[model samples]
Target chain A: MSRLKYDDVETGATIPERTFPVRRLDLVRYAGASGDFNPIHWNERFAKSVGLPDVIAHGMFTMAEAGRLITDWTGDPGSVVDYSVRFSAPVVVPDDDQGAEITVGGKVKSKNDDGTVTVMLTARSAGAKVLAKASAVVRLA
Target chain B: MAINPDYLGREYPAPEVYEVTRGKIREFAEAIDDLNPVYLDRASAKAMGHPDVIAPPTFPVILGMAGSALAIADPDLGVDFSRVVHGDQGFHYSRPLYAGDVLSTVTRITGIKALGGNELLTLETVAEAADGEHVVTASMMLVVRGS
Candidate 1:
């Protein structure tokens, strides 16, 4: 993987879009790894009891999936100096084999004087915006 | 009960060292279904100029969560964990975290606000290296639903 040079990126450059599949099993794995046992992420009954349509994906999991898009594009996890997102909607994952999908896309919003580029991200699940004001600052060679 | 507004600006003691390992990084990467070699393969990471396998951008949340647990579980805070849900998350990193790093975090309650019967609490966790070099600052907003 080659490093993305700061001089090569334009303010409007588009970061390739990517989609992540979210299954119930993925939520279980993430819960174990992140130590977030919020029943809303796994227990459909509990989630619905809370007024949610179904078991929703962990907000952190959705955030991570969006982060993967930037990391993969830059070819270096270290390139990401900052990341943020507001959970606007839940990525509801049903108890089914198909689960759901979160589609991520981004564009270089700005090129900082310090050789860092600000990328504005968009994450949607089930045709609804799941993350808003999503962005990442990445350092380039 | 609503979150104690007086606890705003309260800071918790730094958490014990959180040692980053290849296995943990791998687990996190796999959990997110992120197959980036930089998070799992040292050779691949080296080729990209990192000292070792680097963690995903959000990996700091794992360490930050541990530090936040102190505040969430504090009796004085008056937070109802049963109704809490994640609202927002953000991280500012001075450098990417890598396997073999030992980190510690200090958590502080930054803000408390109530909107339409829902309580929102903001927490800021600063994670530093064992030597006290700042690594990342994480901000999280947790919303506790109204009964």
Candidate 2:
């Protein structure tokens, strides 16, 4: 799929926000996919034993959600050339109504001379920025 | 719980060769809901100058952590798995990972510091192809809360 060219983008351009509800089952599926069988991620009893308030989502899973936010916005997930982030906090997956709502949005920070755009992202959960300082560099196709 | 600052600078053995395949890469891409064709289509990847299907930039973490987990999960390392939280992760790539490449990673404990009631352990994993070409470096920071 053809993607947005870097020259076509402008600084301060905001990608539409995308939200993913993280549920208990998502964590189970992620555990199987990731092989990170940490009890804090899926086993409530084990999490309690370890002092975690409840089952938490894996950092990678959260990162993926943030990544999807960027890719989904750019209209081409493959446009992403380089991405990095600081995991600021945990996304605790509540078994209740609200669950873990991961809201992602991004702003085009700069259009590089090398035909790439630097995008800054914000992933929030529980009213706090979960993936803070998230940024990616995408090459326009 | 306490993480020994002395554990800093310890390097772990490189992981065994992990051959990148379209299937595993596809599964990971699916899990992330990423529909990037270059990640699974060899033809598309080749057109982009990649040897084969390219793995997603984040996929290396799967293999990178295998080597670092030994140190992070070590009970003697003073990390209380019960109170541990993944704090941050960052990656620097020399080149994209492509299918059919045999990759290995060398993990090192980059830093250890106490953050008031918690201890933060930082690890850097460098993934290299069999030919000794650098592929990616993944940096992960885990914070273990003290009781």
Candidate 3:
């Protein structure tokens, strides 16, 4: 059940911000679950050889983290009818327990006539924006 | 090698059917650290009016990518896997995927463009249920880096 109601949302209402920790182990786990075992996502040497600074988290992983924030806020994964994002920058995850943190937040951009709302999301990691033009269209009760 | 622009508009038939299971949903939820009960417990999902446990919004990518691999791995496409990187992704869903649903996908190369010596290939995957219900449309952009 969605906590958000179409009649209750304001155009600028803020969705709570969330921070997800991404570690090297998490990247490995994501690779296994998603079947995207790109060496650059796990091999630091391969990453640097490819001109990347270090091992980076999968772009899909970052997008999934952002999706978590949206789903959590609405309380229903089904409420999200559309989602999209651009891989603006890589979330470099160092081999450490601390790893990296991705902070995601969003706001209601508009309300559609069909009881749906457009949300614009912002995701940042390592003090840099990792996703650009992130947005979702969500249906509300 | 640059991706073969001639492969544009190439379409691939649906790959093997993907069975959506509660375990896969739970695994995906844990992988992303999304501890949503609706994704784990059927009772919790039922409370939300879902017929069964529902997958995370991005869960379709797991199956969608598997289907698209047929196109990405085509020897004729001339794609160098080592040089490819994800550029963009988006999904439009007709409805959320539920546990016990069997899905199949057909992927097509929609566009291929050269930008600053790098090649960008756009692929769209249309997922449908066993009964031909349109489930989701996933679009992806891959950047093949210049040597």
Candidate 4:
């Protein structure tokens, strides 16, 4: 898939926002697949024993979900050349069908001469920011 | 217990070979709730210039964490495995990882510091192809809480 062209992208253009549902079952699957096996992501009791409010989503899981926000915008996952994020807050997942909701939004920060664009992202969960200074450098068409 | 600041500057050799495959990539993609066709369909991935299905940008975290075992698992590091939490992550890609690529990662302890009774350790992992070409660098921060 061809990525968004650098010429067509304008600075400050807002990418469409997206919200993802993170449930305990999703956490289990993520743990199995990612090999994180962090109990704070799946076992509420263990998480509580460790001082977490509840079972929390893996920081990498949250980051990957937010990264889809950038790839989805470009229509190509490989176009993302550099991606980084700081885990600011935990996404506490309750034992429920509804679980937790993480909403991701982004804006084109700048179009570099190197055929890439810097995108600044904002990710929030439960009304608190979960990722800080989140951004990615995407190669455009 | 606190993370062993003494381990700073330590470099761990690459672990066993990790081969990129469609199955692992697909599983990881689904786990992240991303259903990008290029991660599953070879023809579609070829259409985008990759030899085969390409893993997501963050997929290297799997290998990165595996490389962590080389250091974080060391008893002398003083890491309370139970208290460790991911602090941040950064991925700089030399090229997109696709199916059939074999990779190895070398991990180094680059930074160690304390904050609010927590010890933060920085791991800089560089993944290289068999030919010794760099693939991606996964810079991860791990916070080990002090009791």
Candidate 5:
């Protein structure tokens, strides 16, 4: 069941904007789950030693969070057949109750004749672009 | 540290078979705060025509990154894990990965270049199902910052 209808999809239609909070604990969980235990993502000491401003969110974490725009919009997690992004900037997570906030939003870039639509995505952290040239090709009903 | 360009175009096979399980899918989804039923409920996923609970599009990162371990760990390649930062990532899916699908990936260093004293390494990982069907290909770019 394609939750997104090709006939109903309009180019330039806006997908709802959402914000996801990225905390150190979230990174820890993501590290354990994803098996990416690079210390820069969790250890503040290691992060600074390497010249990073602070412990940073895994680029994949930011990518996953931004991808929700497509999943939530299509009502199907698997609807996205293609997704890619350039890591313009790292999402640095501070050790605090309130961590970094990644705000994600997108629009229907185009509807392809191949039963899919292109979504142009934007993600920002601390008002700085985190993901550049983000886009996804999603199948429609 | 400068990377050895000789490692370019070298391919490494996945160290092990990565079995797709609902538990792993759920854990990954929950980790990303994505609780889509298609990743949690097998019945609902099957209802949607998926063989089983399907993984998120980015889930392949686990397999691809894991497969890259051997290649990235080679001292000759001169990759300093501490200095590496992700530059870009992409996934082209032949089809969604569902629970019960076993997979393995072959990782190849597609390119290595120097830009502003930083080493940019491009790795491409192609995943295949146990049945020999191509599942997806994940391409990644890593930037090794200048010391």
Candidate 6:
């Protein structure tokens, strides 16, 4: 991992935006790994029964994708001292057309004197914020 | 059947300590298709000044669900597994969870309410290290559609 220097990042610097397409198989694997077997993530019948338009992706799955964006920008995932996020909307995984497009982006919110920087992040799908009030604190070297 | 709102503030015993490991972090990263080096290589983590390969920020989802899993799955909770949908989730971290940290979560039912005919259960789970230091806190809102 390339070390991100605390001196190099300027407040308001924006991380390059990244887009990841989530598929049903991705949700299946996540369900297995996370031990969350909710059929809303796999069975369309169950999802519709629960009032979801279709099978929806786990919120954590979206969170992980957003996390990848942060680690990618910081160059060192371990440098993140704190991370927090609020779920705003469900990333509905439709059975047809291009899957859910999760676009992740972040901008430096503040440069702290203690060598820590705050990043404000946003993850959107279908032109809506799937994750909101997202932010992370990275302790730079 | 609806869960009694009066049952709010019910706390469940914490789950056993789950020791975070580089292998698990790597597996989680791979499962998520996140190839971040700090979650795989300790050398890279060292280069980044971490004590060890650190798990992803959302890795606590697994650890945090231990206590609430029992509550939500309880037959008495009246939660219909077939009709429930994950409504929302939020996480707040006091510190980044690193490999080798033995942590456990204590989950509590903070609120149980009726929304129309469905049940909304709010859970707050707090994770702590074996040394008794707070690690992370996660709040989840689950909506169980009534039959």
Which pairs of residues collide in model 6?
Answer: none
**B37: Cα error in model 3, Å:** 1.0
Off by over 4 Å in 3: none
Q: Return the clash pairs for model 3, or none.
A: none
Clashing pairs in 2: none
The reply for model 4, stretches above 4 Å from the true place, is none
Best by lDDT: 5
Q: Residue-wise lDDT of candidate 2 within A58-116, one digit each (tens)?
A: 88888888887666556554466678888887788978766788898899898888888
RMSD of 2: 2.3
Q: Write the per-residue lDDT of candidate 5 for residues B66-102, one digit (tens) a residue.
A: 7688878989999999899999999999999999999
Candidate 4 residue B93 Cα shift, in angstroms, is 0.3
Q: Compared to the true structure, candidate 2 yields what TM-score?
A: 0.89
* Model 1 / residue B136 / CA error / Å: 0.9
Report the error of model 3 at residue A62, Å: 0.6
TM-scores vs. true structure, each candidate: 0.97, 0.89, 0.97, 0.98, 0.98, 0.86
DockQ of 6: 0.51
lDDT of 1: 0.90
Clashes of 6: 0
- Number of backbone collisions per candidate, in order? 0, 0, 0, 0, 0, 0
Model 5 error, position B109 (Å): 0.6
